[model samples]
Target: MYKVKVFVTLRESVIDPQGTVAKDSLHKLNYGEVSDVRIGKYIELTLEKTDRNIDEIVKEMCEKLLVNLNVEDYRFEIEEVVAQ
Candidate 1:
C-alpha cells in the first residue's frame, strides 16, 4: 500500500479574494501586520496497491486532474507503507 498527499495552491500574482477576506478578519481581530493570506486544499489518498514506482503515478494524477496547469500549481508525494 501507499499513501499519497496532494497539495494545491494558487500561483503567485493571482489574487485570492478568500484569502483577502481572511486577512481582513485578522486585522479586525488585531492582526494589523497581516500582509496577505492564501488558501489551498490538502488531500490524502490511500492507494490500494503501490510500491517504489508510486511516485510516477501520483505525479501523473496531479498533472491530469488534481491541479490546473495554467492558474494553479500542485505537488504530491507517494510513500510506501511500512509495517506497524
Candidate 2:
C-alpha cells in the first residue's frame, strides 16, 4: 500500500479571497500579529500497490482531477505503508 499526501494552493499571481477574509477576521479578533494568510487544500489518498511508477500515477491524478493547473499548484509526497 501507499499513502499520498497532496497539497493544492492558488498560484502566487492569483488572489485568494477566502484567505483575505480570514486574515481580516483575525485582525478584528485581536490577532494583529498575523501578517498574511493563504488558504489551500490538503488531500490524502491510499492506493494499492501497482506495477506502474508511483510518480507517474500521482502526476496523472493531479493533472486530470486533483489540481487545476491553470490557477492552482500542487505538491505531493508518497510513502510506502508496511503491512502489519
Which candidate has the top score in TM-score?
A: 2
Top-lDDT structure, candidate number: 2
Q: After superposition, how far is residue 30 of candidate 1 from its true place, in Å?
A: 0.7
**Model 1 TM-score, all chains together:** 0.84
Residue 81 displacement in candidate 2 (angstroms): 0.3
Error of 1 at 24 (Å): 0.8
Clashes of each: 0, 0
Cα-lDDT of candidate 1? 0.84
What TM-score would every model get versus the actual structure? Answer: 0.84, 0.97
Query: What lDDT does candidate 1 reach at residue 12?
Result: 84
Instruction: Name the TM-score of candidate 2.
Output: 0.97
Tens digit of lDDT per residue, candidate 1, span 1-84?
A: 788889899998788889999999999999999888998889898987835467777787788887888878888777779769
